[model samples]
Target: MRYLPLTETDRSAMLDAIGAPDVDALFSDVPPGLYLDGPIEGLPHHATEMAVEKHMRRLSKRNLAAADAPFFLGAGAYKHHVPATVDHIIQRGEFLTAYTPYQPEIAQGTLQMLFEFQTQVARLYGCAVANASMYDGSTACWEAVAMASRVTRRKRVVLSGALHPHYAEVVRTMAKFTEDEIAGASPSLTATPDDDGLIARIDENTASVVVQYPDILGRIPDLRKIAEAAHAKGAKLIVVNTEPVALGALEAPGNLGADIVVGEGQGIGVGLQFGGPYLGLFAITDPKLVRQMPGRLCGETVDADGKRGFVLTLSTREQHIRREKATSNICTNSGLCALAFSVHMTLLGEAGLRALAAENHRLACIASDRLAKLPGVEVLNTHFFNEFTLMLPTDTRQLVRDLADKGILGGVSLGKLFPQEDALSGGLLVTVTETTTEEDIETLASALEEALS
Candidate 1:
C-alpha cells in the first residue's frame, strides 16, 4: 500500500497558504534542464523485496571486503581486531537504546559510561581532561584549531607536512568560512623527518601548529622541538593521532608538551565499517582551557545522600546554550562509539594494551624490512609505530590496483590522496596491526615483488 500522508486538499491548502499557483510552481526556481521529469535514469520502477535484496547483495559483492583478503589499507581508517565481548556489551538494551544524558537523574547509567570514557581518554592521551568524544578525528582536529585560535587570539594555523592530507583538507574547509589563514606544506615523503620547514612557518601570528604523531607517512618524529617553537611564539601545539593504538607504545602527546591532543579512536572496539561511525578522542592538558573545549563533558558528583553519581557536567553546544555564547555548534557526543572504546580499554587494561601495541610494531617492522629488500622499493620512515610509507618504482596508484587484482588489499596509494604532489606519486602507506598474521605479511611482500617485477 502507498503511504502518502498529505492528500491533494492538504497540499493545495499548504500551497495556497504560501501563495503558490500549483505543485509545479513550487519548483519554478529550479532550472528546467536540471529537474528530473520522472524516475531516476538507471533505477527500476519497482521490484519484489527479495529481488531488491538480492540485487543489492550482487552489487555489494563487486566491491572488495577488507577481511576477505590480506588487508593493509590504512590512511586514517584502520583494520583492527575488535573483541566479541565489546559487541556483546554494547548491544545490551540499556546501552543500545540510550540517548544523550540530558537529565542526570534518570540517565545515570549513560552518564557513568561517558564519565568513564572521558577518564580513559584522558589517561590514554596523558592529559588533564578529555571530552566525552567528538564526531571523528578530522572534525576534532578542526575544533582543536578553532579552540587554539580562540585561546591565542590569532588566526593563522600551521599544518605539518606529515599530517594526513584529508585531515588537513577538513581544517582548510572549516577555516575557509572563519577567515583563518592556513599554512600547509606539501606531504613529506623523505626517509628523515622534514619538519624544519613547518617549524619555520610558525610565527607570532600563528594560533596553532598541528602535527601528526607518527604522521601520515607513519614516522615518529621528536615533537619537543616543534612544541617548544610553537610555545615560544604563543601558539598551541595540537597533535593528531589517526591511529589511537599507537598511544599504547609511544609517549603520550600531552607528556610531550602538546596543548591539545585529538585523534581517531576506531582502533579500539570499533570495526572499520566502511569509514562510518568512528570514535573521536579529544583531550586538553591545561585546566584553564577546559571551558573552550567543545562537545559534552561527563562529570562525577555526589548526591544529597552523599552517594557518588555521574552527571552531564558541561554542555556548551548551541542546543543547550545561546548561539552566540556557545563554545561549539556540535549537538551531541559519539556516545555509543565512546562506550565501545571505554569497554575495550577496560578489558585491555594498561599491560594488555602495551602488549598489543608492541605486537603491531613488531609486525610492521618485519613487513617494512622484507618489503624494503625488494628491488626499487624504499621504506620512508626510520621510526614508526605500526604504519609506514614506501617509495615504489612505478606509480603507486597502478601498483595498488595490481595488488588488489592479485587478491591482496595492499596499503593506500598516496597519489590517490594527493595527486598534485609529484613526490608522493610513487608512495604507498601500509599498516600492520595485531590482526596481521605472518602469512599475511609474506603474502603482501611476495605479491608486491611480483607486481613491481
Candidate 2:
C-alpha cells in the first residue's frame, strides 16, 4: 500500500508557503531527465511477496562480486582480505548497535573505543591528535581546507594536480558556498609527480596546499619538498592518503612536515562495500591547531572517583554551537566503521602492518613487471607503493568493458575518472593488494595481451 499521507490541501498549503505552486514545482531544481514522470513501465508496486523476492534474486545474480573475478579496481576503494575476527568483533551486540555517543559520559565503552581509534589514527598518520572520524576522506579533505583557512586567515587553496580528482571536486563543490578560492589543475603524464610546479603555485594568500601521497596515478609525490614550500609562505600542508596501507610502507604525512593529514580508512578494517559506508580519518600534526579541526575529538579524563574516563573533548561542529562559530557543519561520524578500523589496526600491530605492506609491494612489483612487459603498455611510475599507472595503447574505457565482458574485473580507466579530458583517456590505474594472487596477475596479463593484439 502507498504511504503518502499528505492531503491535497495540506500539500498545496506547504507548496504555497514555499512559494512553489505544486509538488512537482518543489522539485523544479532537479533536471527533468533524471526523475520519472510516471510509474515504472512493467513492475507492479504491489506484487505478491513471493514474486518480488523472485525478481530481486534474479537481478542480484548480474553483479560480479569482487572475489569471483580477477578484480583490480581501485581508485579510492580497495579490495583486501578483512580478517574474520574484525567482522566477529564488530558484529557483537555491544558494538553492532552503537552509533554516536550523544550522551557521551554514560557511553564509556563506546568512548574508550573511539579514544583507542583516535590513538591508532594519530600514530598511523604521525599526528599529535586525531578526531573520532568524519563522513569519509573527501569530506575530511574539505574540512582540512576549512581549518587551514581559519588558521591562516586566507581564502586561497592550492591543489596539486596529483590529488585525487574526486577529493579535489569535493573541495571545489563545498568551496562554492564558503567563498574559498580553489586553484586546481590536471595531472601531468610525467613518470614523477610535479612537486616543483605545485610548490611554484603556492603564494602568500594560499591557505593550504593539498597533496595525495602515492597520488591518483599511483606515483609517489615528494611530500617534504611541497610541505617546506607551503610552510615558507605560512600556508598549511594538507596530505590526503586514500590507501592507509601505504603508510605502513611509506613515511607518514605528518612525520614529513604536513600540518594536517586526512585519508580514507576503508583500506584498513572496511572493505569496498560497493562504494559506500566507508570511514574517514582526520588528524593534525600541530596540537595548537586542534580547535579549528572538524568532527569530534574523544579524550581521556579522570572521573569524580578518580577513575579513568573517556569524553568528547571538542565537537564544535554545527550541532553543538552557533552555526557561525562551528568549525564544521558535519553532524555525525562513521562510528561503526571507526570501530572496525581500530580492531583491524590492533590485530595487525606495528610489525604486522609493516609485514603486510611488504607482501603487498612484493605482489605489486610482480604484477607491474608482468604488465610492463606487454607490447603496448607503459608503466608511468618511477616509484610507487602497491599501485601504479599504465599508459596503454588503446582507449582503456572500451578495453575495460571488453575485459569485463570476458569475466575479468579490470582496473579503473582514466576516461571514467576524467570524462572531459581527452588527453587522459588511455591511462589505466592498476592496484595490487595481498589478496590479489599471482594467478590473477597472469590472467590479467594474458587477457591484456589478447585484447590489445
Candidate 3:
C-alpha cells in the first residue's frame, strides 16, 4: 500500500547489478552503534489520512507562528511584508514551471528575468557585475572565498569577528576539504567594527578578508579602512549582507572598496517561508573576476533578427563544461525565487525601496529606544539599520523561551549560537522591519518588562 514501487526481487536485482549484497550494504560505512536497532518507539507504522492530519495539527499548534504573534526573531532570516503581486506573478505558468534557460531562443523570458535580477543585484551592491544567483547567502559566502582564493592564488582567508557565525562556518567547512588556512575571529558584541586584530591577522598568504556590513550584532562599521588594509596586504575584501533591504539606505559595499559583495535576498519580494527557498545575491566591482565567479551570468545581446535578447552567457558550472575546468560545482540558480525578487523590486523601484528602508530604520530606532529603557536591558549597537543586539541582565536563552510562552516570538538568543563565549551569554539579537508595527513593538516591550521582572 505504501507508494514505493520496488519489491524485494527488484531491489535485489538492482543491488546485484551494483555488486552489493543487500540494501543495508549501501550503508556499510555507517558504524553499528550509530544505527537504529529498530523502528522509532512512538511513530506509527501506518495511519489513516484523517488521523495523520489531526496529529499534525496538534503538533503544529505547539509552534509559535511568527505572523500570528508579536514576532521579533531575526538572526539572518527576517520576516518582511511581501506583496501579493509577487506570489501571483511567480505562480504564472511561464515563470513558475520554468527551469534553467539552457537554450537562448526559446528561453528569452526566463533569461530576461535573470538578466534583470543580476542588474538589480549589481546596482544594489554597487558592483560592476553580478551572476544570475547562487544557492543562498551562506553558500554564496563560501563561493566568494573560493573565488578570492582563485584570483589571489592564496590559501589563507581572514574572517571578521562581526561576520555572521553561520556564514563563517560555511566558509570554514568548504576550506577544510580544500586544505585552505582560515583565520576566524571570535564573535564581537560591540558598537565598533574593531578590526585591528583582524587586520593584523592578514598576511602575505591571505586571499580575502570577509566582513559583514552592519555586522551580526547590527553595528554599521566603516569598511574603507578594512578594504585598504586588505588591499595593502594583496588580499580581496568580500563584504557580506544578510538583509538586502539594508543596502537601500546604507552606502553600497562596492563603493566602500569591497572587491566582492554577497548576501541573502530574502528580505526583498521573498517571504521567510519557514526559513526559505531563499535567494542569493552575488556581485563584483571588477570585471576581470567574472571568470572566477560561481553560478550563471545572463547577458543581453542581439539575435539574428537584430532584436535585443537575453542569454545565459557565462555558465562556469560542471554541468555545462568539463568538470575539471569548471569554475564552480553549483549546477543551477534559484530561478523562480530570483524572478520573484525581480518582480518585487520592479514594483518597488528605487524611490519605494528607499522609503521602505527608511521606515525600517525608524521603527528599529523606536523599538531599540523603548527596549533600552527597560530595566536590566542595554542596547549594544551605536549605529544600525534595523536589527541590533541587546545585553540582558539574565540568561537570554531562557528569557527568549519565557517570552515565547507569553505569545511573543522574541529575538534570537546569542548564547545559543556561541555557547562557548561567556560574554554573549546574556545577549539577544532583535530585528525590526517595516512590517513590525507600533502595536507589535509595544507588545514586545511590555512582554520583555514582565519577563525580566
Question: Between which residue pairs do clashes occur in model 1?
Answer: none
* TM-score of every candidate relative to the true structure: 0.88, 0.88, 0.87
- Tell me the lDDT of candidate 1: 0.89
Model 2's lDDT to the true fold? 0.91
Residues 1-453 of candidate 1: C-alpha lDDT, one tens digit per residue: 135689888988999899998877778889999887777988667677788899999999998888899999898888888889999999999889977887778889898888889989999999999999988999899999999999999999999988889899999999999999999988766776777888899999999999999898888867888899899999999999998889999999999999999999998888898887988889999978898888888888998899999987755544467577787767767889998998999999999899999999999999999889998889988889899899987889998888888889999999998988887888999999988888999999888888888
- Please, what are the lDDT tens digits per residue for candidate 3 over residues 75-121? 78888888999999998998778767888788999998888899999
Q: Which one is best on lDDT? A: 2
lDDT: worst 10-residue window of model 1: 313-322
Each prediction's RMSD to truth: 5.2, 7.1, 5.9
Model 1 stretches astray by more than 4 angstroms: 1-59, 316-319
For candidate 2, lDDT tens digit of each residue in 409-440?
Answer: 88999888988788888899999999999999
Prediction 1 TM-score vs. true:
0.88
List residue ranges in candidate 2 displaced over 4 A: 1-57, 316-318
Better of 1 and 3 by TM-score: 1
